[model samples]
Every structure is written in structure tokens, then in C-alpha cells.
Target: MGTIDQTTYTLTCPQCLQTEKKKVLDKGSNYGGSHWQEGVDFSEFDVAWAGGGTSEPVITTAVCKKCNVPPSIVSSYS
Candidate 1:
């Protein structure tokens, strides 16, 4: 199986000024490989994947639990 990296970040809601913690997975060399099939838990936030097809996928946006407003990614770390 290929290695999977996990990254955590904070997302802030623009409408309600709320902050939430989120996690994302980096398939790295596994990219399109099917070594893993587990679902990621996003808790109380909504997330979207970006930059697929030609590049690595990244979590770029999240939905705020407070007002249901989608927020931009603030910062992330492995």
C-alpha cells in the first residue's frame, strides 16, 4: 500500500466569523492508486477537493457549521 499523509488546518467563516478545524489527506505517490478506500471524517465541516486530474488534490474550501457559509482555507500542516 502507498503512504498517505494527513494535514490539519483551520477554516474561518466569513459570514459568521467562526473557526473550525479540518483534516485532509495527501495520497502523494499513490495519487490515483487504489490502495486505500477508507472515508475521511470531516466532523462538522464541509470540504471540497481541488486541483485534481493534472495535479495533486488539495482541500481548498470548507463549510462553516455556524452559519453554513463556505470558508476559504486559512492554513494547513502535516
Candidate 2:
């Protein structure tokens, strides 16, 4: 086991276009050669709301400081 190299990646949400800072663990970008995923994976869920729903996918991985976002935090920039 080794340490993880984490980086602050400022990304904007695709749907809401909200800017949020996400900590990404680049195992491939490690000092040595750690080829591991971000220890975490963003779960996907079907987007459906009032009236009807769109075919688009609503993935929970953004922390909108304002509003118009999912009820969750901690995610990677897709």
C-alpha cells in the first residue's frame, strides 16, 4: 500500500454549470506508477421529476453552493 496523490480540480457541472472544487486522486499521475481509480465511484441514477422526466442522466457528484442541485456531495469531475 502507498499514499495517494490528490489534486484539487475545479470543475463545472454539465447540467447546472455550477463551479465546484473536486479532489481527484490521480493514481496514474503518482510519483511512482500507481494505476488505481479514484478510490471512489460516482453512482448513477435515472433523472425524473415533477410532471415528467428527461432522458438525460442525473449523476450525483456536484456540490452546488447555491441550489438547483442534487442532495449530495463528494464527487469527481466528469
TM-score for each candidate, following the candidate numbering: 0.47, 0.28
Best by TM-score: 1
User: 1-78 in candidate 1: lDDT tens per residue?
Assistant: 344665566767788776767554545364465232232446656776665433445666668676787876665556
Record all residue pairs in model 1 with backbone atoms less than 3 Å apart, i.e. clashing: none
Report how far residue 75 has shifted in candidate 2, in Å. Answer: 14
lDDT of 2 by residue, 2-74 (tens): 5344544444545555554534443433355554332232233222322112121223344444444553333
lDDT at residue 64 of model 1 (Cα atoms) = 68
Candidate 2 regions with alpha-carbon error over 4 angstroms: 13-17, 27-33, 38-78
For this target, which candidate reaches the highest lDDT against the unseen true structure?
1
**Local distance difference test values of all predictions, in order:** 0.59, 0.38
